[model samples]
Target: MTKIIMRLQFSKTCAFSIVAFLFLFSVKAQDKPEIKIGGALRFNYNLSSWKDGQKKRGGDFGYDMFRVNAKGAYKGIQLNAEYRYYSEGFGGGMLKQGWLGYNFNERDQIQVGLTQVPFGIQQYNSHNWFFNLTYYVGLEDDHDMGIKYMHTSNRFEYQLAFFKNAEELGFGNNSEVSPNRYSYDVAGRNKEINQFNGKFVYKFGKKSASRLGVSLQYGGLYNLDTEEVGNHSAVAAHYELNKGKWNVKAQFITAAHNPENADSEDRAVVTMAAYGAPYQVAADFNMYSLGISRNIPVKLGPVSNLQFYNDFAYMEKKAAGFTDSYMNVTGVLVSAGNVYTYFDYAAGYNHSWLGGNFVDDFAKGNPNAVWEARFNINIGYYF
Candidate 1:
């Protein structure tokens, strides 16, 4: 009788094992890996008051950039990468962003590798091709080599990150800092390192149409000449509101840099570089920006939408005898099928990339510098 009962128990155990194995196999078969590839080609036309030669020649039009993007996901693991090619004068070919991430669930995830810094604003702070003044100072749309953690929900979003440094030119312990990059960084005699960032956003209004946020950043500046570490910090408060066809954005930021430099080097300004050239930026400054845009639906041939926008930003230096900088952009974006174009009229005073010499305009700016204007058109096709 005991043997009979033991046999019955053994049969039931085998059936249970088979069922569990089949269930596990089915789950594995349902999970699939996915990948997508895409890119864009862009061209630009410009007429600048500061460029007398080009202006006399009826402006210049040429290729702007070509970029490739890739993304993939398997289970909860994700990958994203982008590479861009531009004229040698504009930094040549470089990696814009690359990251590997793992999703813990629907509301949380972590990313490792080169990723965008959570700063004053996300993605962009302006509507025009030329972003706000904060971008020139590395406070907007900056990317770094780091690990970031993100959490999202219905009412709040949070991001925390620690970056070892800006993307290095090569592997191993290399000290050479190059200006061949997409984003500006400390490049001359000093390099950015050991950075920490945190950002928080609160969402409100119907369907979360509005957001208010704050961000903080602190980082070390490693001076190769002095062989000492200095520090930099920035704080920002930002708000965005979207109601029907109208949108508005506003931000205020303050930043300071204290670098340990050789005795002969200047302390009032730090050298920042990108796009194949180095420029000097003020060591201490406060910046603010406000932008507004309105979207209108249209039907003209392939045209489907148009967005008109105006963005303005200003920077005030704290150093003695230093001048301030400001930029204003008025533009319209046209969207048609897979093609988009921007028509912008930009003006700047004592600002980099607008008129005056690129290097000193953001540093001890020329108090005598007059406002300069540029009419720009950028068109791109995406796939």
Candidate 2:
């Protein structure tokens, strides 16, 4: 027990040292436009029915993640960065976002480096620990080593980008046949190295500010079993309404893959973002999500407001033999400045990804426990 505590402390200390150094360096820059430093500590409590058996719940406490962000503009040249320290799931505390920007004016600019892949909805609208399904699918916070040109006006925004690393995943690894965690590359397959993405968004209404967006992605997929390269494409349409205390978000996405030699369990997939099923290649699938949130006019000690939300997603494969799945999350949050707390209940039907609990439900052809419930509570303090 002592050893575990020591190790955890060591890791956090190292991460803090790096963040402190970066902040100090930024402070030295006389032209620094804005310099801010912050991170978060989170605690999670969860209930898993199958893992702990029926009607039983178990959970553990541990580190979630810490992040530091810095952004500044000196003489029209923008410098921005956001680094993270977490359980090396995707990347090992690497630069979650690091970029250098050149602005020709306010409406146009070019950003180069590891940056966001503008696809689907810009962000997600869920209180789950892992983000929405779009993230598991490589659409949410999926950043890549690439460059992009962006244009923005009062009501229109557009972006064009090329990423060489596909999903910018697979950094810490060994040689083994396993599920590809962050990248689209199939286990024991050639990696995806080249891709292009573009997005356009239009904003309307000043009071109830609404946005509609369309995105397209074209990428190359490498086959492990056949040693060949294939093509993959995806198109998405998204719409959101953010006004007053009500927020609504919705998206429709479809993808197609043409792989040389791949089976249903192995193929090029962007990410496990929201597919609760096995991976398949040479297939067509559609995924959609709708979310709504509202803020209640109530405040208490250390709790500024009360917020409630619900999000739902449905995913289906076009192939005849493929399985379909749906997931739903309904939760409430309490927000007090930089501190937030979440209480949520999530349920899945026919979910089959990542040892999901709904595998037996498909075999029995019934919702059964697949539609059972799990409760989660997360308390976080952001600095």
Of the candidates shown, which would achieve the greatest TM-score relative to the real structure?
1
| Candidate 2 similarity to native, TM-score | 0.76
Candidate 2 lDDT at 187 equals 32
Q: Give all candidate RMSDs, comma-separated.
A: 11.8, 10.5
Clashing pairs in 2: 136-272, 136-273, 137-273, 189-224, 276-352, 276-353
Tens-digit per-residue lDDT, 78-144, candidate 2: 6788776656553336556788777656798777677787787775535445456555445566777
Per-candidate TM-scores read: 0.91, 0.76
Model 1, span 123-222: residue lDDT tens = 8988888988988888878889877889999999999988878989854453657788888788888889879999999999998999999999999898
